[model samples]
Target: MQHRPIKTAVFPVAGQGTRFLPATKAVPKEMLPVVDKPLLQYAVDEALAAGIERLVFITARGKGAIDDHFDMASELVAGLKARGKTAELASLEGTCLEPGRITSIRQQEPAGLGHAVWCARHIVGADAFAVLLPDELLWNPARPALAAMHDAYRQMGGNIISVLEVTEAHTHRYGIVTPGRSDGLLTEVRGMVEKPQVGTAPSRLAAIGRYILQPEVMDVLAKGRRGAGGEIQLTDAMAELIGVQPFHALTFEGTRFDCGDKVGHLMANVALALERSDTGPALRDWLRSLEL
Candidate 1:
């Protein structure tokens, strides 16, 4: 079951961040700062941490800012050098990726997550690929969640998706997995149901943002089979891979934040801030002083 190493990761950033509204009008939601760094940076860092070398971004119109954020800015670098703002200059290191390491594809239309992933077919070729959704941030886990998924991927070598337990009552809000035998964190994904009705879910485990999918998923998505929302749902395509292909859902090892939601975004910022030595002490004191 040897397969090409998961060297590349695809990011689907084509959806309009209507959830963020005016702020997203000019700034891509992916560009929204989680702390001082943009949300996308965290996702990129996770990919890099997990041994991902090349990044393929599926973007749409008005999302040029994503490229700009990663593009090396000569003037800014020179200014930081002249000013001797060592800390500030070093902070920019995460933002500028090496040239040619990133490939951006225009998604033309916001068909769905599956469509966005399908656009990267040629880029991914036949190798197994990783997909990280910027909206879902795995806020500073003890270790990289994707890295763990990569570990499981190398051993199991099918399709791996990171999942977390949601309350049984809240199962309708996420893509639920029909779980099979479990070995610690790894659970065999016998089946999947996207946003199932409240009482009809197969299990409490819901899919998260991290994924290691075979390239065949692109071909499945190419069928343009519309599911929920009349859009080509990635879950539906991934569901098509079960039984025939080995599918397992790995329970995430870290806390995940849905930055797509306003409260979750704020919580991520505060949580990350509270973990920083420079800000933690003061922030902790301030939080203690507050009367909730």
Candidate 2:
């Protein structure tokens, strides 16, 4: 079946980063820096790398910083250019989107992931779209995780979700997928249970933050039925499409860090910092000297 091209992606960033406390009180969690770039920028770059043309950000109140982050910093760029800061100016490349290529919609309230995604339904309009959570930072620059999912979507053409094998004990923390047929990284999704009760999970394969969903799922979320945690869980909506639509999970190839958690956020920064040429040597040396 020929599928509509996946040209757009939805980023659900409306959540208040209560986890980060004082730091997030003034800034959106998505705007928190990983190493040098903010968390949201990494997700945007991944989407762009996957040939996504339009970016739909589901934002909430006080999230205007995200919109400003993507806007061209005219004064900053001019200052760098005047000072002959070619390197700084070059680093800003690809940060700004083509006018009209990006759009932001307000979530208004702290709804669940499903509602946040549904907010972009009008903007997405009949096209298969991707939803990327800024919290799950996949560290695979050479072949972005989303790009890999896009490749699978082109071949399978239904609903593609990125999965990772988490420990059985940790199944309750994620939306676990029951495997049907396996073909290396691609597995037929038999079913999904959002944060299933302990010892009740079917499999250890859990859905991460990346998803390429068909537009029909929007109608399902439109019902506004609450699921786990009293939020309109996207997993519940996607589960409904499993038998009706072709749903498959791709075992993503990369190290994923859940930056929503404090420890995970720190790990991402240290890992990325260690990979940087400018900081790697010094950071590695400092690490080697650690008492722990």
Candidate 3:
């Protein structure tokens, strides 16, 4: 039997993005544009393509602009109309969402990823909700990672997390899930260890920032203690749910960009730009001529 359809997704965007410094001083990191679109837009677009009917953002005090981005810009619309830019106007119209479709909850504290997700409990209620980390952008998949997990969730009938193989030496950077025998692309998760020591990790299949979690996780998050980095790590709560539920790790095929990091952000731009037919040749020529 297919599991319940995932109709809503939670995006955690409250953290103070200190890594980007002055750029993030006033502007939210989620608003940082990757090429032409902000990082958050890519995530929102991805979610929408994944059949997510509603979006719940866990935001803090300084995230008003994010809400505004999706709202229609009246003045811009007027100018586009005057210019007869029908295509651009239509794109903007498409971006405007019904107010009720999007909701926000205040995290109040910079607790952790777990806390951010927990804040959405009232909104998520008892349904299985997909979680998408706005900073992780995937490119050119027929569906986003969350959608892939949604498919896995439907088939597996349990909690599903997106997993990707990372360099074993860099395993500490993610929550690694130990794998058992795999049935096609989904692997049976024997256990998950967050940032395990190098060479001691059970598997290099680390959890990407995508999840299709049961509502029971909210209770676990409520009781979860502070873990790595002195924050309420979501991995801890997920770890607790492993044995209780049929947690599985899905190996999704796609190019994922870590837009959260400065270097990764640049890489996403380069990779995406090269894929655009109009810009590909020009960008290729420019890269070929660059003297390293």
Among all candidates shown, the one with the greatest lDDT: 2
Range of the 10 consecutive residues with the lowest summed lDDT in candidate 3? 87-96
Lowest summed lDDT across 10 adjacent residues in model 2 is found at: 89-98
TM-score of 3: 0.95
RMSD values for the candidates in order, in angstroms, are 1.1, 0.8, 1.6
Deviation (Å) of 262 in candidate 1: 0.6
What would the TM-scores of all predictions be?
A: 0.97, 0.99, 0.95
Pairs clashing within candidate 1:
none
lDDT per model vs. reference: 0.92, 0.94, 0.86
How many backbone clashes can be found in candidate 3? 0
Output the number of the TM-score-best candidate.
2
- Candidate 1 residues 58-167, lDDT tens each? 99988999999999999999999999999999999867877889999999888888899999999999899999999999864568889999999988999999999999
Candidate 3 per-residue lDDT, tens place, 142-255, comes to 767777777777788878998889998989999999788799889998888877877888888988788888888999999858998889889889888888888899987899
Worst 10 residues of 1 by lDDT: 138-147
Candidates sorted by lDDT, best first: 2, 1, 3
